[model samples]
Target: MSKSEALGAVREVRLSGGTIRYRERGDGPPVVFVHGVLVNGDIWRNVVPVVADAGFRCITPDWPLGGHEVPVPEADLTPPGVAGMIGDFLERLDLRDVTLVANDTGGALTQIFVASQPERVSQVVLTPSDCFDRFFPPMFAYLSAIGRMPGAIWLLAQTIRVRALHRLPNVLGFAAKHGVPAEVVKSYAASLQRNRAIRADLGRFLRGVDKRHTLAAANKLAAFDRPVLLAWAEEDKLFPMELPRRLAAILPDATIETVGDSYTFVPEDQPRWLAERVVEFVRKHATT
Candidate 1:
């Protein structure tokens, strides 16, 4: 079956200022999956079925510009703007007591949401994502610098196919360890390679991470009272496991869960394990 077919059924929900493409199933409380950067909500296709089977309403939204070619207004697509857009999504739907499962850039946004609106968030499980001022693994400094150079984005567009990169084990050791399916890799690559909406969103999200916001989120994590689950992929080439360890120290009420055989795309690598862990974490902590 195709990946979309594997996802079972999905529906699109449009908010006042943006669109949220999500799939819903299962029978318990809500569990939303927020994917990493450059990836749409479809990345969770492998895992959502397991989540749905576990008796939870698995709600995974294609982030604005991240998937489904959703049109994001130029203004609302900015970093703070996207953050606000996330808040608006939750409020508009009145999705309370939600368990936000995020990875990569999505994970970072979850941190911001919890800090800004703790009352709305119930539990969180995050994998590799940006937290401090610098890039993960320190190698991103070069990429970030390159991406910022004049005409660099165009050069990248000309020279690189993000999909192909997804196949390189040297690129993401964790993905290799967990044996990422070629189809999933292709889907992820297709979105990154072909989606113009994501390009706009990526530019804004990257530019939005200023020095102040990084420090503020870090500080906020130190004081947050809500339960947090820090799941780090030891083989992640992008964000090293150290980042999650640092996060564990910062989040006042957090427990670290290490998954050694996955990269930033934890779901793609170990969907069943990740899904089961997420379900358990939510069941154990959602009330606190």
Candidate 2:
């Protein structure tokens, strides 16, 4: 079941009538990891071991438009749709007492799932996610515009020029400031390059957002009395670090942990630290 960067400790399941791909590993209580947009479950390769080693069953899924080979579903892959798919998958698996670890768009989806079906979820860990109304940074606008342009996206997919030109600076800047290893970027790039479907998936996945889901989740978060661990990167380049603070304000029982100088790829840049903190947080809150 091992394929490419995604180490296979379990069978990969392509849900019927869905574009998402999934695999489960380890043994014990279930811990499902949902990755950010444009990132496959392979993104969790470095981090999954920590959770698996901690005596918990680990499940990582290739979100639609997330993996190199997997295509993002043709249907609207909105945040709410993502939430619905996850709920459906969980129900199909009959998974009980689950812990959800989500980052970026995955985090936003997690919020929707938690709000809609709180009883099905046990604990949550959200990191470097875009779940608020904070104005998107200029880079996002640039990426969005570039991604939206058919010709630009085609050129980007055909050659390494755009990524080389656009991402290099940001990568170097992040490494220089945060001590993030260059290998992490290379690994992330490998996942990005492994398949063209990921690029295609990105085009559909990054359609901004529907504020309804965001507001609905926020309202539920404010009212829900669930234990949530809000881990945010201190040097987030895409989304502002202040978002976790806003999330904390809304979440009834939430605690914020800062990852100093990490970017959106916190798991890769600081795997050991993140693993320790996440395992600890889950241990403390999962039982209640």
Winning candidate number (TM-score): 1
Q: Lowest lDDT 10-mer window, candidate 1?
A: 134-143
Worst 10 residues of 2 by lDDT: 171-180
**Model 2 segments more than 4 A misplaced:** 1-7, 14-19, 135-137, 159-199, 208-212
| lDDT accuracy of residue 227 in candidate 2 | 82
Residue range 61-174, candidate 1, lDDT tens digits = 777633445555554654456666677777877788888888766776777777777777788888777677643335444444543565554445443455466455444443
RMSD of each: 3.2, 3.5
How far residue 37's Cα lies from its native spot in candidate 1, in Å, is 1.1
* Deviation (Å) of 193 in candidate 2: 6.1
Over the stretch 1-288, how does candidate 2's per-residue lDDT look in tens digits? 114243445444445435455667678888888876545676677777887889888888776743445555454566677777788777777888788888766888888888888776878888777676532234444545655677554554444323444345432343223443434334334444555655665666556455567777887787567788888788777667678888888888889988785777687677677778778988887565
Cα lDDT, all candidates: 0.67, 0.66
Candidate 1 runs further than 4 Å off: 1-3, 65-68, 135-137, 142-165, 168-179, 189-198, 286-288
The Cα error of candidate 2 at residue 103, in Å, is 1.4
